[model samples]
Target chain A: MKKIFFSFVMSFVAPMLFSQSYKPVQVNFKPMFGSQELVLNDSVYTFNLKDSVYIETLKFYISGIELLCKNKMVWKENNSYHLINLSEENTLHLMLQVPKNIHFEHIKFYLGIDSGMNTSGAQGGDLDPTKGMFWTWQSGYINFKLEGKSNACATRKHEFMLHLGGYLYPYNTIQTIVLPMPAKTSAIIVIDIKTFLSAIDLSKQHHIMSPGNNAFLLSQIVAKSFSPWIAPSKK
Target chain B: MDSTFQKISIIFFLLVLLTAFVWVEETAFKIPDNWPKPKYDFTKNPLSENKIELGRILFYDPILSKDSSISCSSCHLQYTAFTHMDHALSHGIGDSMGTRNAPALMNLAWHSNFMWDGAINHLDVQSLAPISHPDEMGENIVSVVYKLNRNKKYRHLFAASYHLSSITGEQVLKSISQFMLTLVSSHSKYDSVMRKQSLFTNQEKNGYALFQKNCSSCHTEPLFSNFQFVNNGLALDPDLRDYGRMKISGDAKDSLKFKIPSLRNIEFSSPYMHDGRFKTLNQVLNHYTKGIQKNNTLAKELETPIILSANEKVDLIAFLITLTDRQFLFNPAYGFPK
Candidate 1:
């Protein structure tokens, strides 16, 4: 009777002890132009272009997401840079899990790559240099990529890939993003690209590749886009 | 058939087969009769046939690239002294052009540093640069390890080589370095002359004298490089704006400094310099003679202009040519596995 009871307990407890699950969160990206909005089916994001802008190519990376609850840090995933290549699809879906029993006041992350990763040699996944996020001659990461053709521009439909990344002194693209969580279960941060276009005056600055005032400003705008959706309604 | 006696017999047969295999692959490396002892402390990673074989496969395999398009062999080809000859600039995945020229890779165990700038301090970490460079192998060590770990063939190879069920990044890098360190190039005609097995022609003899007088101060003999840092006085590049040693040391005194490259096989390895600017031997000699610009940190030996005439230049070129080791270049063992 003793041996049978022990076996029964082992069978019931083994799976429960081994299995670890995390709460899931979904982010929907939408592009917009003027008052019109286009839902990206694959990665469809809205970009509010003040004027007609020719879209050639758009690529960028998002990284460094941390989950927290009740002012206690729970899970921190650093150096997680993922490219958002718009040419491939119209919408994007990224499903990530936040470990259970995590307590924190808010969730924090970064829009661009961290400083260490920019110089951490080649990496797999989204951080690979072959992904076109790395510069060959110069040692730096291309933080935010935006390139297209415009008649008003002097280059005029010329190939443009604005790789914005600088980690050294004077120029640093490692921007911090903080999101306040709702009173409920999880936090969902949506990046509205249409808002990004409206925030920038393209007539003043069209292309930016290196880390400078432009990168710092652009990263700030991107971070701001995530702030509004930080704590959705409790409904 | 399923009795204990049959099982014991099968185990005994397996042990004998394993011993036979070990014996067959037990070919040990023999250092050249008179060369200096290798600086690599082989005890850290013992010289074994299985590790070396696996290293060679990884070195030649293109799966290290993101799209499986480029490999170490793409730049460090076996022939032409293991330095690419197709273009001065080394090309990586997606036809991206690297800023620096691919240096010849041989006698690596004797050298203490790597790259034109010596960014990496250890041989174990040297492969990391190329593996991650956007214009080179264009892959990460982690991804490469994961890819290898997922493959059945690599799992078996790793088991045989490292006795591990799965391979790690450290193992992968070390294994490749093992094969590269085995690329000993001490069998050149120059080496034979040192051993008194052959004789140099009159022109070659004269060339050696000139090399000793003008070039030996920097391009030392035996290794053909003193493994020292010096400023040879190449003008600053405007576009790339690369400042070689200073960039790493962060010291202004070391500005424009570069690791002195080995003159061994200078014939096939061109164009020269960190950027491969000088394509001909004459151009290099001319730079040493008339082109060396005065700088605060220039090598004292090259501070004064080297005044070599046409004949002297020819003689120096002849001596540099003798450093070529044809035996090592065409060695079938270094070739791709059939």
Candidate 2:
């Protein structure tokens, strides 16, 4: 009779214990140029004051993700580096494991690759050298890439290329972004590219291939463009 | 009971022997006596015999190039102290030319930066520059990996080296780095004299003293290079107009600055300077004495004329020759894989 009672208790207790440990949370990144959702390679979006600019490629790295509750650390992702390529639809969603029953108020992440990973030698996956995000002339990785056509640009095809990255002092381009999370389980982070490129005049300074003051200023603008939106069901 | 005990003892002894063999292999990469600690962090990519051999093969293979006509060895020959002997500037595939001269390859594990411009900060990714340069190999790393995957021999080599079934760009770069790390040139006649194993001639001794006074500040001891970018006051060439480190940093103060090449194997690595403007040691010495063009960013040491008699110049050249390590230049271990 004692053994039978113990088995009944174990069956109920095991699942409860498992459920309390951790839960998988899906974080979706939705790229937007203003209110219009971006459809990669299909959507023709216009930006800048005159709305004569359009982007052909926009890709960047987001890393060092951490969850906070009341300014206290709750959970952090391991090897959290991710490359968000708008052209590839599957890369938009990221799965994160968070502690169960914890109220996460904010999500913090980096806009570019961290300095630690930059110095470390060739890595696999999204950080691989073959990803075309690496610089051949220099040893550092290109943190962010924005290439597109702009009528303001006087160059051939009216195109501009901005590849930003530098880890060293006085020119560090890494930007930290923090978004308030209303829902603990899941949220959609919106990146508005139009707002990010509002300040720059493409005609005067169309190309920024290496890291410097221009890259740092641009990355700062990008960091401010992300905002979290909670779905009604999750709220 | 006795038979069982004997079997257990034999098994234990075999295990001990196997462990020792593994330990020996892991500790094969040695640090030379009195040398500074290596800048390369070896924990990330552990050294092994198989990886080094694979790297040597890759170093000599022209398959890394676009048309399979140029290899790393084309510019870096073993006999000329791993530098192109005749060319003022490095020539690439299709007879295309590069802006700067190809620097010598030796004691690279100690370097914190690569290239004449100091553009590359690490050795592992240094090969990517030449491989992707339009005038150089003109091959992308992705295509290189694809080509390496299709080749049967590389497939076998990658498997043997990395114990993986497929080839990767990371593995290819790391293996090449392992081979380069083995190139530690600490057996020169100067090294022998420092170790008390040999004595320098009177001419060499005099030159050594002269070198200590004039050049040692930039071309530091032991490594023979300070490895810092400085403006040595070479006038800009109208055709090339290469600004060196300033091009990378965009700082006007760093204009015309270039990495100081190591004086080791100075006898063979000519023409000299970033542009290889001087074909002889005499020309380099003459420039130091008279050809220093005054500029805002010129090295302060070279501001005043370097005073040296004709005999003193010959003595300095003799001392520089002592830095040539015959063992390193002709080491079969570093030569083409047979």
lDDT of each: 0.72, 0.86
* Model 2 per-residue lDDT tens digits across residues B90-208: 98899999988989999898998899988887788898999999888989899999999999999998997777888888998998999888987889999999999999999999999
Measured with DockQ on alpha carbons, how good is candidate 2?
Answer: 0.35
- The best candidate by DockQ is 2
Question: Against the hidden reference, what TM-scores do the models get?
Answer: 0.59, 0.91
Task: In angstroms, give how far residue B202 of model 2 lies from its true place.
Answer: 1.2
lDDT of 1 by residue, B1-338 (tens): 56898999997898678667656654566777866777665766666888888889988999988889988888888887788874677888888999888998888887866788766555665776888887787777668888998999899998887676777765786788789889988877788899999998888999898888888988877888888888899998898787898775557888888899887777888778888888888888888888887889888998777788898888778877888888888898798966
Residue B146, model 2: Cα distance from true site in angstroms: 1.4
Q: For each of the candidates, what fraction of the native contacts does it recover?
A: 0.00, 0.61
In model 2, the clashing pairs are: none
